[model samples]
Target chain A: MTSSSRIQRRAFLGRAGGVVAGGAAMGARLAVPVATAEESAGPAATRKSVAIIPPVAAVAQPVREALAASYQIRMLDPFVRFDQSLEEWAAGRRAMGDSLRGCDAIVYAPEPAPDRDEASLDELTRGTYDLLNVAASQKVQLVVFLSTLELMADYPKEFEVDEGFMPTTDTSVRRMSLYLAEFACREFAREGKLRCITLRIGQLANASATPASAGPLSVSPGEVARAVKAAVDVGFSQPSRLANWEIFHIQSSHSQARSSTEKAILQLGWKPDQD
Target chain B: MKVLILGANGYMGPHVVRKLAPAHQLRITDIRPAPEEIVNEFPKQEFMDVDVTSVEQVRSAARGMDAIINLSVVRQDPILAFHVNTLGCLHVMRTAVEFGIRRVINTGPHFAVAGPSYEQMDYRISPDIPPHPGIGLYPLSKSLGQEICRTYANQHDIQVLELLFYSLRDRHELEPGTGGVPFLIEWEDAAEAFRLALEVDSKELPSRCEVFFVFGDIPQMKFSNKKAKELLGFKPRQDVSAPWKRG
Candidate 1:
């Protein structure tokens, strides 16, 4: 594909329009229609509503704060804990469906404790699966699934794996679960039900520390919050593609083997804030 | 027909084995030994403990078989998931080509081409669309496996049938929205798709490497299985939804 086509395929809505408009201007003079009163007011005149699922996680708090700065934020209750009978699971699915209704978009960040055992892991898996289903059923326009950079563990230690590298062949439950979540989001995105942006986050520093830079390896919570906000903004602005999904490696900038931040920079207009 | 079935202990393994038992001579292999009931039921069929990830084991079992059907999958474990789903496929395709096996049937989830998120639920998705094999390791690995099949098919002139299944379970077990997608397939219907895939004359196949959506007919959903219906004669025998009206 031509570089221009690739950009059109991968660029965020606003930039993509600029590219198209640039191309059109060189071709022919076209009649422009007069703007209506509603059209003149611009997209910002109406605030887009975003529903944040399980707003209790550490990541969720920063993301919520960042999003609340621009969009109208709605916090869905914490997801039903995984250890429940079939009846309870069904009820939880229904409850999730109810919570997501009328929301323009959703931010899903399930925070299972780090020391979770097999049962808890299973719960996490099931909960994610159910949540995806509910989101689809509710017809939410965009879903920003918070995934971790741990998926990069399987990459050769020396290789600087970027978003373009295909996922490695690890089969650990954690990696597999994250992979499945990514799959579900992409599947929904492909079906044109919503736009899914998977932020493969790096190691998060303490909330208080102002990291000097977004090094290639690690990122701070504040950086993550900003990334989430950028993604949410793009999701609202872009017209969802039938196969509209993207994976970006969110990390601090580095001189060594740059953790390919080009896609995030170009698409989301996101640059890591070192200060 | 002499058929080698890998991952014969999975949920669909026994059903497939039982379905193919009457007409085809079968050799079944899995990491675990085949259950005794299956052994007793199909006394003529041979069972072997074969780990698909082990190229040697797979090569050994694949010898002298007319065709190979890969059912092996690891969903939860990342290491084994890649080993089995991706590398295992490489072994199967390579072995099939080496042994002059003409046809291979590979099973995978529908997410391979269904795009990741449900953002485009308004129109039907056909098999020909470039696969958007969503983010997770399972689908990613499986999609890679399909790529392997495509490579072998194109390079070696082998007929590779990649069946993209939505959800495969018994009719009684299927719920309204199986696997969180608007599509599902009863085990029997899935088995029938496989059987028909095996029976379709190679000359009739549109391409050497082909993908077919193997799910119960759900016109209401945005996925189309018309290719499977027209090419392989895949007649879905069960509709888990609205079961009372099923004929």
Candidate 2:
């Protein structure tokens, strides 16, 4: 069998095995008829439904494949665009919410369009915050907010960045955004109402990336999808009690930023077979 | 091996103590009497009162210990930064030579050898990078600390390894709405890194003084553990957020 096939098979079996193990541990009372994937004794083929919220419809095709293969994901196309008209956006937000209300989980990858942030960065930030609430009020089991890596450009001098150390305080705008999302999620998680996982994605290698932005430090749509699957089914690193907010930066195996990427490969079990 | 750690009361001090306790006969020396409360905390170890900057105090603490790990520094007093980092380090190195200690592991920030600007670049600040202190007493003092290792390696034949780490967010979560990930090392991972550093053979201490970054294997952490993985064989398994898991 091809290496990629082997990996996919292994991933499937591992996930399937985990569910079966969980069910078996729960005893006969919890046993259910779970059909394993044919042609391979792997995890059940049944996929979990996921709702995706993006800023615009510039949906990367590879990302679509990864999510569809692993999850029963519902894509809210023509991604949300915020303009001067609040009323117009509200109608759109409600439509987006109505479509997503039935999914088991929500995934947000909001990329502010050129016009969306013309009003101001604050408006864009607030608009996304409102979208998150749409998911929280519905009590989705999991909400994964995609994010970016903690690049040096992201922070001012006050917060230091080292591969092996954490700066005592971070004053970066990028860092601040992540903290805000986690903070919002914490209030909801407090009542055991919802679970939130913030993914600090690396630079993605899609048509969206320019010559100046391509490299090892970036992530791909496919990689992000696999990561989302890993996070949703394989499970996430727990939420912080300091507020149940968790953050993860997703990057592919070929990150151009040498040491940090190498460290990720060795430490976390993340490796990208595709470029 | 028996190890002595100075600054046992500081932020990373107790962690060094806990990490080394399992394999080495650990002797911790702080400026003040390690509080009864804190001493009672790590039951299997011993504590001593020693002002690390003093030659005599450090010399006394050096007796019977095979190596020393220094973490104490002058916080507000920038002038004193040189004294503790340079002179104080001189005292520890001299004492180690006199006592026939085989190895010494020093704590330095990753920036000790690189500038804040270099952080954005795609490179690892290996020990080979010339020590470059940008601004701030902390980085400068740490640079001097790196120099101390160089001096000891050249003159006294004492082997020293400097460990640099960042993204260690065990103390507080990044405030909400920030892309700031919990790039943190739990108290456990911090301890383990030091433990591995303390155990490495003096001969294994790479010539020209080496720097290794240490921290937990969080997906979003900035500090990379690549070198530590190769040299110390240290792998951190604990996820700071894992303990918060629930159905």
Candidate 3:
């Protein structure tokens, strides 16, 4: 089979085989068939937990602060954004593992470096996989990633310049970033250890945005916090392809200047407090 | 009372066991093979292997139990979302009815009330939306599952407690977002919600069939927890700003 076919098959089977039975025993795996029912039901309580792993940087501080309000979260990256030593980074990851040892869910924020150089993307990608592996070891329940919606729009030509593959030209760069984020989420959802979520956030209307527009298409840090809280509070149905690795456009209701992201707000029950 | 826990081995199962073990006789069933450690912990709880889809197995498994807390779902199949969530729910409810059991606390997502759009802001969603749009099968399935619960409540005289659960968390994996809106109900709060649903009077619930948001009192809660509080008397004790305790 071709590599693409293999990947498709893997995705199919991963979804099919991961049917979790809730009670005395979960759905039987073909391999395990049926273990003693006594062995099935108790681990769920003691075994499951979620962890958040954010990339350390000036930009991510707000995001980190937002996650803390609603989740049992821990930040793994050092405060130093660009100046950390190799030892510091390693210690940070090791420390992350220690923090995540007993958890079953992981909300990951893998920040893209200012320069999307091959080395930076490659390192971030590899590091992402490494985090996935760590979650797998701990049987983490879900993996949520903060992906960029603007990455596609703000630098569409640049992204094409950087990476030879561009999937579609139909949508705007921002919408395309949402799709790309989904692609990455699909790629990383392996071993059932990682259930990726790419928050295709629109232009963040923090205090940092240049010359303010009169339109209502802006989102604030406070709004982002409320959105993330909704994502966390809304318990998930079984982690399936339904919403798994899905890319959501993150914006407020008033930001309906374009279309509205009322769909996400409705799904997770998120109501952002406006400035 | 003899109680049967579906998904008895899940994140909230052990906690359920902890809560229910004090007074009732508990039996747990799941698809996962029983873990040795849990066996050692609750030696008295009988574990059984039965798929909720199989009506015969459900009937047989539910025969002597007073209540059934279903927590099973199709993990991978988007198409099976409805079948597992709705049909499985129907089967469990029907089984409960057959066995003369009245109370059933089934696990459901808060998204059943809201949809993908609701994820952006924390707001109250009425249980009256015309089912979730078929965005994906999971929400559809969950919406259908809620329908089944309503059917059982109306037709079979079974009291169904649908906990519209969201962001249930442990200490490590939880992420309380920064915005002032509260979301993510801590696991302890979830436990309390279920416990109250299990213990509270049927009249005390919202309408004959009720949908309660099983979330902590995060400042920016997507679904309103007021009904849950009013009916079930569950007050979330966790702080909304503790994790991101901002100035």
Candidate 4:
């Protein structure tokens, strides 16, 4: 059987419990020790090709810089823009498949925007479906899906809303779109069509210029991009710890941090930069 | 009560309309016109052409209604699935809030809450737990709508009753030995559950949004329909466990 099949088979075997205990939505994740040099999945000797499919160019640049040295990065904004007519989506999806042909993995980070409305959700689903379809067809090795921490904003402020906690989202189109997009991602991962690492980042702000909305939920874009790179790099790190699907909380360790990035820390070797 | 039934052309819509028509004032709306037989059966019932995907259309269709029963579902197409299954929900709830309609009945397959993630491993799962709607587009999209309904119910005064079902079989035609169905409800029995949901007082419910697994008493013990029985007083008339035969 292929590696993908092994992941698929493992998907059924490890889930003795429904959802991951520490991580919220990922199917099955295990606690494993760090791999030795020989077990390093992603060797830095040769840079791999990765496609960064963010919601916009603004979010793509930081991630590009983070992965520039470790992997050759290409941006595919259309895959997550959620702006396409039915015909346009279908045609663009076919074109997007070609764009993914040479990439080893895809980083699909779709953040909710202020301008996003309810009507754009159809496009959101279509875009995500297109990405997964194209990624599967093109034999992309992995897909790191970026979700938002806002989905869990409704949890009590004093509560420690770790990755294990269930996500709570409101009816706004912005948050709902992200919530829906994550579902699509979960399904694709469950099928084992593509190994996925869903990083639910907290209030994402630029490393240099903090957005006004930054607070306890704040995690610098630099940290998020680094997490994305670690998600892509092979140390045999995640394939061993994560099931075909894995969800990890990505955020800074604030005094009042809402999420726990323990799974990301152990599984992906993702560490948040403390300042 | 003046009820607005959206997507009244699906499999279970006719059954609900048939059951509710004599007592309640229903304005049935669907993208396609109701069959001549249905229109002819309830001459006094109002019928309109409306697509749930369009918020404006749903809003217009919901005018002067006391309650709304949303049965809109699109399982197949990639794009239309979200349009109808996911976004259609937002329109329904927004309309409910706008019209001061406090009662809304939402429907979806059991996988909307208990997908492969739960079904294969967990037995006797209840609908109240956190939903783990895995990869299938049909369930995933519909579950998204379910959440939207829950949000509206919690935020607004609207009462959303999500009745979940997986398999609907003719009571007499049930195949033997599980028939690859973990949960099965009689077609008519499933329709009756909707009526109970519609009639149950919103004040008596545990919360503004509640989920119930609407199925018959199956022998597989794969799920618990006790919540439906206790809350909505939903009792299946058919012997749903006949397929197992106790063999």
Best model number under DockQ: 4
Between candidates 2 and 3, which one is better according to TM-score? 3
Q: What does the lDDT read for residue A197 in candidate 2?
A: 63
Q: In TM-score terms, which candidate is top?
A: 4
TM-score values for chain B across all models: 0.93, 0.84, 0.88, 0.96
Q: Give the TM-score of candidate 2.
A: 0.43
- Which segments of model 2 are wrong by more than 4 Å? A1-275, B42-44, B120-127, B171-183, B202-205, B218-223, B240-247
User: lDDT for each of the candidates?
Assistant: 0.68, 0.54, 0.54, 0.74
lDDT of 4: 0.74
- Per-residue error at B213 for model 3, in Å? 0.5
Model 4 is docked with a DockQ of: 0.43
**lDDT at A22, model 4:** 16
| Candidate 4 lDDT for residue A29 | 16
Off by over 4 Å in 3: A1-275, B119-122, B126-130, B172-182
Off by over 4 Å in 4: A1-45, A55-57, A79-87, A159-161, A206-214, A234-239, A252-275, B171-180, B242-247
Q: Which ten residues in a row have the lowest lDDT in candidate 3 chain B?
A: B128-137
How well is each residue in A8-105 modelled by candidate 2, as lDDT tens digits?
53333211000000001111111111111112123434555666554232232344555666666565542223232445555655665666565667
CAPRI-wise, candidate 2 is incorrect
